[model samples]
Target: MSWVHIARKDFADAGRSMMLWALTGLLILAVAGISVIPYLLASDGTTPGFEDGVGFLFSPIGLLIPIIGLVVGYQAIVSERESGSIRFLLGLPNTRRDVVLGKVIGRTGVVAIPTVIGFLVGAAVIVALYEGFAVVDYLGLLAFSLLMGLVYVAIAVGISASVSSRAKALAATLGFFVLFDFLWEFVAMAIYWTVEGSLPGFDGLPAWYLFIVRLSPGQSLSAISLTLIDFVGAEDIDLTAAGRVAGEVPFYLENWFAWVIVTLWIVVPLGIGYVRFKNAVLS
Candidate 1:
């Protein structure tokens, strides 16, 4: 069978299940937290209408998409391993590369649909309510949302392919997702606090320190997403002087550099995991 057929079947299995329901719950919570509450509690008698609400609603998509990706992709290979079916697949003439690529594509489709739908619905609501909507900006935001999904799905698939136990796979995915999303911010904040003096006074910190912080997939992605949202008037994040200085790097240079970093976050661990899975002992 073609890998496309396998990918399609996997996509269907991942989609028509409780994962969709969980994603819906997350959408409700995020929409409510950022949009509904803020709208209802506005001190001014006139609430920001649906357009403003939708803008607010999308602010958390960056945080939520990765979690959705983890939930959707974490069992792709690990569960097969646990049930002794991975060997059966390997027994086929197919290459391990096909299996890995197919599973990643399938899982990506599963998460991508809800992400696109939620984003469209929110954008449509905003257009209906707002007098002048920047349609192009919304499209760019949707694209960024998908990138956010891709990043975590890649990470989760790597974890799945490398692990043996389904439970451990799930725990590792959730734990790492939470750590990267929440704890990483705490660590970054600690760094900022520790070097507040040097950060302001010194010529510059070592490239090593910047590289370590830049490796935070969540931090960089979230910052970029927030900047995009701010440009669209969706969110109001204050850009520090440091951020402004960083942005002054040549556009082409900064763009390619950022892409390289994002690609590394998605590719390096996945390549490592793929190598491990290819060499895994299947007895």
Candidate 2:
């Protein structure tokens, strides 16, 4: 109950900030504006289908949503600590667990609101320009994007709670983004090269190799996305482990298992953060 009040207050405070509106506007551009690209790029006399728009949208969304989540959540708790308001917050009935939980819920709302709005506006654009508009598929992508937002926010918030300083939190979160989003593929490739004596290609990839690649939050979400949104030409190119692996797809590599991985990403960090924050001596 205290966490609920804390969550409400946190969201209300954020509601008053121009930062919230700014994020909403940015997402509007990212979802609605970026979704228009397929139509614009379509060849003459060819009207792009809804799947085409969703497929084109996946790339930018995969990149953008995580960054946004990190940015919004990184400072959620550390800022209060830095400003010495955490002592005031703690002076209230709220426990350390409540604070962390509240921050997660509040910051999640901060990301989700704009994301939902952006998707709403994007739906209009897709309906107008695209030939076949599948409402279920559209909702699927939106749900996945929201889930992605939650995963990153949980991570960033966890970092914020564990760190005493905002700078340290920022550094850790940025390092996470750079490592996972930018260099994880290279890391996986290097492991594959070192072990297999050659780089992994489209098919014939080992199960362990695919598992290593899927460890990143983005990749896990991407795997889940294959199930969520039916991209144009998805039949021709199989992104799933079943398509890439030589033998049977391992249970861990199954499409449904990606959700388990993503859930772990959310839970492990928050659990660790809560434990650290719980034991910290508040001066």
Candidate 3:
């Protein structure tokens, strides 16, 4: 019961943010934006439909949602401490666990609802407007998006709880998000280049390297674009296809291992953060 109230308060706090509304609007616009390309290309009968567009619509999650998570969660704990609310909340019989769980559960629910809505909206739009909508693909995307949100939110919350200053918390959280979500890909590519000769070529690469790429949130999200390519039989159309049909390339994001990695990314960080918060002394 106490947790419920805490969760409610957390939810309400997030609900008042203009950024939250902006995120919702952005999602809607993303869904609508893809409509233009199809509209333009339909004249040649070579373009895909709304279902095909769904992949691109939600593609931003590979980077956007993580940044949102960082921004939303960076202050969750440190801000309360700075304002002297942590002790007061503790006085109300709220344990550190309650505070932590409530905040995570509440905010995760808040962010995830819109993400799911965006997923469903994108899927529905594709199904209604395009002939290429596939149930498997839609389900895959929904599952991936849910896990992605969880990972990002957990990362943010963990950073929030661990830091001492609001400014430091925000900076660290943003740094983590940008570093892991965006920079990691470039790093991976660079590493690939450095070790290219010692490492296996594309044809001979080890399962571990393959696993890393697929497990990467950015990679997984990018791989979702392949769903668009596969469904429309445009596998050869987009640059994303790269060398798949032309060679031995496998669809990395579609692999189950990727989801497992994403799951681990969320679980490991949150677990560590929660344990730390549980032991933290409120000033």
Candidate 4:
């Protein structure tokens, strides 16, 4: 109940800031604006279908949403500590766990609200410009995007709670983005090379290799997205781990298990942060 109050107050404070509206504009641009690219780039006479828009949107949404989540949540708690307001926050019968949980909920709202608005705007544009508008599939993408947002927000907020300074939180969160988004593929490739004495090729990858690659938040969510979105010709291109593995796909590599991985990303970070914050000396 106290966490609920904290979440509400946190969200209300953010609602009054330009940051919230700025994020709304950015998401609108990311979703609606970027969605128009496929249509404009179409060389043939055929109008891009809803699937085309969704497919084209996947990469940018995957990239942008995580950064947005990190930016919004990285300062959620550390700012209070840096400004000496955390003492005030904790003085009001709020436990560190409540603060962390509430910050996750509040910052998640900051990301989700704009994301939902962006999808709504993008939906109108897609329906107007595309040939086949699949409402269900589009909604599925939105849901996946929101889940992705929640994951990154949890990560950034966890860092925020674990650290005492906003600078440290920012550095840690940015490092995470760079490592996961840019270098993760190379890390996976290196592992593959070390283990099998060869770089991983398109086909016949071992289950462990694929599992390592998918361990990153983006890859896990991307796997889950394959289930949510039925892209045109997706049958021909098997993006799932089943297509790459030589023998049988392990249970861990299944699409359903990606949800478990994503859930772990949220819970593990928050748990670690809570434990650290619990012991943090906040005089």
Worst 10 residues of 3 by lDDT: 238-247
Q: Any residue pairs clashing in model 1, and if so which?
A: none
TM-scores for candidates 1 onward, in order: 0.79, 0.96, 0.76, 0.96
State the lDDT of candidate 1 residue by residue for 196-215, as single tens digits: 64342232444334444555
Candidate 4 lDDT over 1-283, as tens digits, reads 6899999999999999999999999999999998899999987898977788888998899989999999999999999999988888899999899999999999999999999999999998898889888888988999999999999999999999999888899899989999988899899999889988988899898899999999999999989988898877889989888899989989999999999999999999999999999999987
Better of 1 and 3 by TM-score: 1
Candidate achieving higher lDDT, 2 or 4:
4
Give the Cα error of residue 108 in candidate 3, in Å.
Answer: 1.5
lDDT on C-alpha atoms for all candidate structures: 0.68, 0.91, 0.64, 0.92
Off by over 4 Å in 4: 43-45
Highest lDDT: which candidate? 4
Q: Lowest-scoring 10 consecutive residues by lDDT in candidate 2?
A: 233-242
Clashing pairs in 4: none
* Count: clashes, candidate 4: 0
What does the lDDT come to for candidate 3? 0.64
Better of 3 and 4 by TM-score: 4
